[model samples]
Target: MPISPLRAEAPPMRVGLTPVFLDDQVSFLSRWRAWLEKKLERQVIFVQRGSYREIVELLLSGKLDFAWLCGYPYVRYRRQLKLVAVPLWRGRPLYRSYLIVPADDDQSRSLADLRGKVFAYSDPDSNSGYLYPQYLLTMQGENPSLFFARSFFTWAHRKVVEAVGVGLADGGAVDGYVWETLSETHPRLTAATRIIGRSGDLGYPPFVARADIPEAQLHLFRSALLEMATEPMGMELLESMRLDGFITGRPALYDEIARMAVRVGRL
Candidate 1:
């Protein structure tokens, strides 16, 4: 599908989705699209991108009407994008990041033990995958780059888990919600991974509409999402995404993420 122009007219609200790795997970995207079309009362389309940055750029440039964005990118571009809502996992407004190692590895037990070890981080714009992990490392009085012998970005939480599981890296950070979901649904992947430490809870990604979208349309969009978790089909779709509920969100809630970004010199 083309990156822009959802429809010639505005009858069927065109909603764009940015799945974490659309290129490799066509089935997942297909299922998500089908679910959205049936439940959201809109013509849903999935927009594949190389990274979170690309997705944020698309949203900021007015190429997409709405997007599901990570916390870091949302915070970075809040001035340009309006926060709509976010999926709540396990009835909480936030999730965490797990610093994981191989289940059998005995070399590391804490953040301090990881000194000089290799580390794998997810996309730079990820909250549970990157920001919180970086914050935790800094809290320990260790610079992430200096403490790790080598580091790289995986751009996906699953790849970070896989890297740690296969001993490709001594340790890495993965989204806690993703880890829990994978453990429950994909035992083979979870069986090989173990969490050694966890970062403080951080807000999950939010579904945002561009600042230029009409106020009435934005309200309608938010209303549709606010009631989604209660409807039968909406409940099923949330379950498929491993979400418990959806909550209204505002840009101010992410000020902490932006502060952290500045502290880490990422801003």
Candidate 2:
């Protein structure tokens, strides 16, 4: 007798989120998860991790069916991920990088004036924090490594603010949204820093699904997100995350980020 062939099993949908909420406000994430679970009608689990880099790694490894990732990381992994949605900041789908210095420092007014000064970068992989600022510096005919006497990556926007506050570095580029959020909620840090300049706006971070996820399911996820800001439960979650709404997005939205990375040879 011939042996029967076995059928393949479909994998369950798995969603992953960065610790953006946890880092800024954990209470909000808890409420968000509860709301997401009810809205999706599925068991939604929140993966706790140390950094955004780790979240990216987990998603790339097929552990997550979908994820929310920063713009640069999403651009870097666009081949393996599908752009789903991105949040609008201050009524725009894009945000900028802020070159901040001590509130009392009046010596440096322009990028060129920072020559030989110490600088802090949120992270090497950060789009607004590192890449865009570097691009802006290049446009001004300055290389960060050559312009600054020393530089350091603090790995978090708050740390960048803290570093500047304590006079550890002369100044640094921080995500404008993060700066705004911190300034509004955490007055101590923002009080110590002042924005001296702003880089050109770039696409904000996005929600993405793995490339192989079923199209039907992706559509459902998108619909769910699009309605999140309206539902009472979801509205509370959005407020917790300091977001107004989620908007539809395209992969091409992040192409500039990839091009910048390639130009800087950091991709």
TM-score on alpha carbons, each prediction? 0.88, 0.88
- CA deviation > 4 Å runs, candidate 1: 1-28, 38-42
Q: lDDT value for candidate 2? A: 0.76
Q: Per-residue CA lDDT of candidate 2, range 1-267, in tens?
A: 111232234234466765332255666656666666566666566665556777787888878878877788888888998888888767777877888988778787866777788999887767877887787777676775788899998878778888988889889888888888887788899889888898666788888888887898788778888898788877766766677888997777788888878877678
Best by TM-score: 1
Candidate whose lDDT is highest? 2
Model 1 / residue 45 / CA error / Å: 1.5
lDDT per model, in order?
A: 0.75, 0.76
lDDT of 1 by residue, 52-163 (tens): 8887877788777788788788877778989888778898767777889887787788867778888888887887777876877787777877878887888888888888
Worst 10 residues of 2 by lDDT: 1-10
